[model samples]
Target: MSDLATLGRRIRHFRTAAGLTLEELGREVDVAQSQLSLIENGKREPRLTLLGAIASRLGVTVADLLDESAPSPRAALEIELERAQSAAAYRELGLPEVRATRSMTDEVLRALVGLHRELDRRARLAIATPEEARRANTRQRLRMQQVDNYLPDIEDLAEADVAAAGHGGGALTHRTVSVMAERLGLSIVHVADLPHSARCVLDLENGRIYIPPASIPGGHGLRSLALQAMAHLRLGHGEPADYEDFLRQRQDASYYAAACLMPQGAAVAFLERAKRERDIAIEDFRDAFGVTHEAAALRFTNLATARLDIPVHFVRVAGDGAVVRAYENDGLPLPVDATHATEGQIVCRHWSARRAFARSTRTTEYFQYTDTPAGTFFEATQTGTAESDEFSITLGVPYAQSRWFRGRESGHREVSRCPDLTCCRRPDADVAARWEGRAWASARVHAHIFSPLPQGTYPGVDDRELYDFLESHASAPEE
Candidate 1:
């Protein structure tokens, strides 16, 4: 069917669903009944203004009327091609406009389909700028919360694999590489130049895992990276074909690696033992597991609620107060904009995640008590430097759960009304009392807030760049 027919059918369906007759809808949209009947019967295409009016009257979007999902696959492809060709970029490329027609040849349709596919792929692979990365992180954070930071199927598979490997007793050591390699029948290769930001890569076809020489010197980091690669094999995860799939696959692999390093049952037992001492020290946990503090804190979030019976929140923030990563099982309110809180937003200065940056020693731990709209929370935070960038990591519990943590005894405390101008921690009062007029700090331009990805593309991407990317990576190896 033609686009007009598909749109007309949708309009009719929604009009009937709203219990509106042709005359009634015409009256609501200020159009004649005869014209509405002509449009609904596909005899005439409605103007944009008329279409919008009809959609509003029917309580639907114009896009809903044109939704390609309701049409046949070929029709949907044609509709997509029509939409793509309308873009200025496609016109600039001097690409031929492919119209939707019932008698269009299969060869022509196939060519159009290939062009559309290439354009889409390019949009997906374009390099993300810093702002784009931040926005993507923000969206991914919200998505993670929607699923409650749990993937039961992946977790079950990891747990079963760990049990099978019989490497569950003590902290995961460098020896795990040998054991897993022997058990899974895989080869491990270390190279000097793998890829930037890539800890390890798995060649599924050859059953070889490649690691960077730099990451191997750090025993814990190496073990974690290697185990994460092993996870792809153990859990039977295929190579990710898209950006979203890549993120999900990485997360699953990371979770699997953590599970392997700190098996669920053993981790729970350790937390139970720590609870008896009323002091849950992330550094101690890290020492016990030969993992980084951040890794230990993330592991704590995984088992805190189920095993320790304490809901917790974890955040990692950069020195500049930007949230790098965050997760929470507890209902403790973290400062968020219209979207769910993730990376990119500048956290309130009153929060421990930001306050920890002010400590005299970067290595020292800092603690604070805060009261948010949700409830009071006690947070323990510590700072570390990696490659010249300082980051702060925080682990917080509800006020009631604070008693079970070592940081609970700290004298530091503050009440926060964050994301508000009149927040108690704001220096507005002090400045007003003294040098309000003499001092002025220009409002910092938040480029990330305005640098969102273009519509119909992944977060922080331009359509043209995406098209180019897709064209280049079309035949890239799965690994």
Candidate 2:
């Protein structure tokens, strides 16, 4: 239906529900009865101010009157596919254009939908050029930044689960893990030959979890991994059929795992004590909870936002300057492209995350105070190894909150005017002035460039080879 018709229908419905006649609404909104009638009949479009007045007088929002009913999900998908077919990208993909009509047969529609789905799958599986990946990452980062990296519903559910598990007052332990597994009727089995990338897998059909032996080395890592796997079951997450869903599910699982590892009430109490002591250390938190630095940082953010009422930002960056992961619940300005891609972009060397790599000793924590266009931030960073890659994780808060954190009194400070050419710390000029032609830094190539198609399409894995290996191992004795 036309915009005017939809608006008129909504207005009429609201007016009837409010038991207001045309004259009554007109008088309250200060519009002529004839004009209101004309608008209600779709003969005229109302002005914005007048619409707002009418909506207010009718006890509704202007949007309620203006908004039209959305199309069905499947129909919306069809519309999107049609639009894609008309785009240069789809045309370049060699997919035929699909047009829809009321008289089209069900078989034809199904065929068109199937063809579009196949083309989309192929496009995703195709090796994305660096430029393509960058563009996609930019879009993803923008969507994430717009929300300030908070997922309230998931956090609420996680906190509720923590309370239900009676873990509200203490650090999580193996006993808690065993109790949870038993409560859920899940069997945990250690597998020495699990894939390096796979931490733990949930076999829902068998009510069992298969985890690598390394995950169980007496620290809370084993419990964390088990909880991570159980998150999929507890949250009722299903097999993700798309990349976006896969990322979301993984994030949810990670959040749930963190929540289990650091129960909200206990974590908040710990932070309160740390804040009072003015010694907020990520490592201290990590050691206390038997979690990784990344997990500790994430849990800190959660507490900062949900409990302590402090805004914070956390980032994990690889040696090559690619952002592996990031989260912010504050107005910290991040270096991003027009598309807001945070990953795979070279961060400014002046930022604490990048500066952390310059430390002479990789094990020691590095702290810095940086002044940016947004605000001054106090950051603490440390390096850790993930698989074969070395990365620096930085946790930062606004300068106002720095007094409550450790390393705030550090004298190592820098001024950064990033995403602009005039920034004092220009990598080229500053580095060149320092080293001239003597200092040489070798660039490291990452496996991500040529690794398997992400979202679990093993790029070069032969199905036959995989099947044969599995068959050969089927009767092998378990550890």
Off by over 4 Å in 1: 1-120, 126-148, 214-218, 239-242, 362-364, 424-479
**lDDT (Cα, 0-100) at 290 in candidate 2:** 78
- Ten contiguous residues minimizing lDDT sum, candidate 1: 452-461
Model 2 collision count = 1
TM-score of model 2 (CA atoms): 0.65
Candidate 1, 1-479: lDDT as tens digits: 35675676678778988998999999888889998887875568888888888888889898888774644555555556666777776788886876667699767887887877787667655645545544556666667656666556766776676667666577765665556766787666666555443456665555666676744464777777788888877767764544555566677789888877777777777888889989788888878877889999998887787667788899998887888788887776666655454566677778888877777876657889988877889999989987897899999989999988887888888777776767744567766789867777988765756754433333333445545443443445424
**Candidate 2 residue spans exceeding 4 A from truth:** 1-148, 160-169, 214-216, 361-364, 387-389, 422-444, 450-452, 455-479
Q: What is the lDDT of residue 186 in candidate 1?
A: 69
Please estimate how well model 2 matches the true structure, expressed as its whole-model Cα lDDT.
0.72
Backbone collision count in every prediction?
7, 1
